[model samples]
Target: MEKNLRLRKNEDYKKVYSRGFRFYNKDFNGLCLDSKNNGPRVGFTITKKYGKANMRNRTRRRLKEIVRLNRDILPNLDIIIVPKKHTYTMDFNSLNDSYLNLIYFMNKRYKRK
Candidate 1:
């Protein structure tokens, strides 16, 4: 079974969003960052403005699926995905491609030490 990388706390989310580098792609939202030696982790952001509880969780689940599926292609960097309200309508294929592209984009910007 594959594990889902997760952002667990308010501080962690804030650090990734405010301090970590970001990419806002047409189909996805991303924040890529150094882990300061704790290895890679990930987080998801879905606001109530997106919809009710189900909608928010659905966005999160989709993001987690994309990341989990492409784990091997990714580098050792923290990531966060903040879904736009329009994201709920996106199909899995678009989400997958967009997410993988975002990961590749991040990989290009940050070289492992």
Candidate 2:
């Protein structure tokens, strides 16, 4: 992912978590808020309970790639993706589908400009 398209600040994550609209399914959870930037910015979060550092890093990488591939269609928003334990063992295609589904619903529900 590009540096400008990533949510890196602690305050940014906290603001999204505290105030953003949330969506989720069996695979992952997402929080999104209106962005001040020109394009969508994304962040991946995996807790210690999810797994060790290596496992969490792997899951983060997969999610990042999924977002990177579809970044152009995304809205101008700040999004935080929280992957569940199920994501670690899930196939790439399935994970991509899950992400797309989440984004589809989010777009339908939040009519942001």
Best by lDDT: 2
For candidate 2, lDDT tens digit of each residue in 1-113? 89988999999999999989999878889899999888889998899999899999989898889989988778788998899897899999999999998888788888665
What would the per-residue lDDT of candidate 1 be over residues 1-113, giving only the tens digit for each residue?
Answer: 14335667788778887878878778767887787544677787777778999988878887777777777786777788777778789898987887877777888876555
List pairs with backbone clashes in candidate 1: none
lDDT of 2: 0.89
Candidate 2, residue 38: Cα displacement in angstroms equals 1.1
> Model 1 misses residue 107 by how many Å?
1.1
Off by over 4 Å in 1: 1-4, 111-113
Model 2 reaches what TM-score against the true structure? 0.95
After superposition, the stretches of candidate 2 with alpha carbons farther than 4 Å from their true spots are none
